[model samples]
Target: MAVSSYMTDAIKIDVWSDIACPWCYIGKRNLETGLAEVAGDADAPRVEVTYHSYELSPDTPVDFEGDQTEYLVQHKGISREQALEMAARVTDVARDAGLDYHFDNLKHTNTVKAHELVHFAKEKGLQGSMKERLLSAHFVEGRHVGRIDDLVELAVEIGLDADEAREALISEKYVEAVRADEEQARAYGINGVPFFVIDGKYGISGAQPPAAFSQIARQVWAEHQGEPAAV
Candidate 1:
């Protein structure tokens, strides 16, 4: 965690994550829970959340030749038993966050195009929807996120113009945006997924519990108001 910049007014949270990252999805759910907890407080700052790009497995093939277990066993250099154990551990964590993680059905593929679609959706004011859809498509429904047709169809499902999304992906329109986000992540010393930067001041890493994020939100709100720190 490193200090970036600041704003004493409304709160802004920028998240750097990837669609293929399970912990990122859990982190998202926990963040929403945190926001809900703070929403009841009249003194809480207005919060705006933005998602950025971070590819956890950039080297994964567009059409991955194996399943998640095999990929983990190969890419992570773990035994088959270890890969299954890791998946089970993450599955339980995701379940706690209300995510039905079907790792067996998950399609492990390159997420560059999916990240590009997120940027494209951001331009259309639907980045959040796109992010959720992409995550669920990969983790829950086992959709192939690397393919253009599947991504375009998912974009259309979220009310985005299919033609525009297709064209953007074809032309690599948002590749620079994705790269810029990665550069910012690197500069922030964020080497992990599900990193949250709050108000450009506080950095929270990993899929922490809702209480952890809520506590920070309360503290940030109190600080901005020049009041004693909230308990």
Candidate 2:
């Protein structure tokens, strides 16, 4: 008898998101749940995930105050009651996904530089950690992610060299990479965050429920199984 690995088929899901977008985080959690459920699903197929970038507000201020309710009412022109309702809805969604969002204290920063940093971090194999830290810093600690000093320090906290991180930020390395993702997002007609593309073909948008995402992913995965071999 010979031992064999569990070599099932694979599905690639490319997700486009901005850390500043609460729904993106909510979507991230939902997609993960969907993926895990699919992996163990009796009817669905397994998959892999890769995150792509999409800057929600590339022009947001660097030192802006962290009060999202105020920001929405003042900046985006949302009414106070509307802002509160929106926040409340998002809070409920996050809770469903097991997330503890600190929207009240979240620092709203221009995420362009942070997105650029992620482009570079992805090259260094630290994409996942960098993404997590950046989001947590903005959403949890109220850190100004747009500042080079703050971002570099956060990078260091997540195990990268501070000086090197600073250099990357100052030199604007990988700026084009971030721009490229933006371009791609535009090409895809993506005007929102938390968009998911399955195998470069199907597009799924919004922070939909786990069951919804799981159903789409399973459908795509099954289709992938029967495609004719590339010549």
Candidate 3:
């Protein structure tokens, strides 16, 4: 049986996010929920998701001097009490999205190497899994994501080759790929994490509600249906 292009063609979703960014994790969960909501529809298009690199704090040290709260206070110039309040609000929102964020345990670090790891994972067709693992390790498990050894360990946990992963980071193989993604993000005039480029046409920022993702999916699918199927 001949399949229609609508069923065969995938709607590409390019997501720019930082592993260290709490909102990016929440946005990841929300985007997944939104995609799943429309998966059961007969007319729904297959969605292809690719996570791009965006380092929220590129200048941060690998071993930060203090905790997440202290970093926020220093960088954002907010009071300690305000940082705590902000963390609590974000934690509550994360819980609503079924994510348990442990701000106290989080290790603030530079994410450039982590972003490079993601680029390597993409080549192995495990980018999604790698990205999820990195986020959970940073937000929930309080793992160190900046070091090469640590990232290799996380990659092994997700079935990637530890030696290969380590070598990739040690040799800085995917650093340029990471930089390319950031360059593209800048070209798009994006200065924030958790940004979504849907079908390469629509740009959605922040952790929007699940309905927003589903609505955009349906709208894009409808537009694709109007075009003639490829021969």
Candidate 4:
């Protein structure tokens, strides 16, 4: 088999998601699992994943007064009972993906500052780590992601400079970068997440299964090699 230059180069994956999004975390796990599966192949190309900003609830207050259920009830226009049922279903799905979601403890807030922190981490080559930390903190630890102080603490936990991160968030240094991502998401016709643009061509929406991710990767790899994808 002849290996093309594309096979050797890394595949670029741009993911648009929000810290407050449960499905985004699950999709992240699935994407990682799928990439790992493909990586076991000797001829597989490496993937470079970059997460972008997408606020599920941009108008959400930094300090929301109610619980996840109440927020859902008010925002989603569902009853409290329905909100609980929805949370339970999402919790189960997240647990299956190895995520410990605590809706009861979740503090729903605007994620713009968190997104800015991510961009700061990206500048430091720690975007993935920062994103994971922010998600885990928000969903599992019930941490406040919308505040500069809280985000700075999380940044330090990931080995980022506390002072630098604080300044970045305070000055909204990466606000435009975050906005640019949102703009691009709009341009791509993505109204929801976790939306993925793989290798700048393939688009995958929602929290797809791990197999779905691996299959797409393999198909893309095959196409790069000018070969028909294996069914």
Maximum-lDDT candidate: 4
- Number of the top-ranking candidate, with TM-score as the measure: 4
| TM-score-based ranking | 4, 3, 1, 2
Question: What TM-score goes with each of the models?
Answer: 0.95, 0.86, 0.95, 0.96
lDDT of 3 by residue, 1-231 (tens): 244645467899999999999999999999999999999888766889999999888889999989878999988999999999999999999999999999989999999999999999999999999999999999999999999989999999999999999999999999899989999999999999899999889999999989899888888876666754322
What range of 10 consecutive residues in model 4 has the weakest lDDT sum?
1-10
lDDT of each: 0.91, 0.79, 0.92, 0.93
Please list the residue runs of candidate 4 whose C-alpha ends up more than 4 Å from where it truly belongs after superposition: 1-4
Query: Could you tell me the lDDT of residue 50 within candidate 1?
Result: 98
Candidate 3: residue 221 Cα off by (Å): 0.8
lDDT of 1 by residue, 41-152 (tens): 8765578899999998899999998888899988899999999999999999999999999998998899999999999999999999999999988998988899999999
How well is each residue in 1-231 modelled by candidate 4, as lDDT tens digits?
346555566778899999999999999999999998999997885678999999989999999999999999989999999999999999999999899999888998989999999999999999999999999999999999999889989999999999999999889889999999999999999999999999888899999999999998888777776789999
The ten-residue window of minimal lDDT in model 2 covers 1-10
Residue pairs with colliding backbones in model 1 are none
Collision pairs in model 3:
none
Q: Select the stronger candidate by lDDT from 2 and 3.
A: 3
Q: Point out the worst 10-residue segment of candidate 3 by lDDT.
A: 222-231
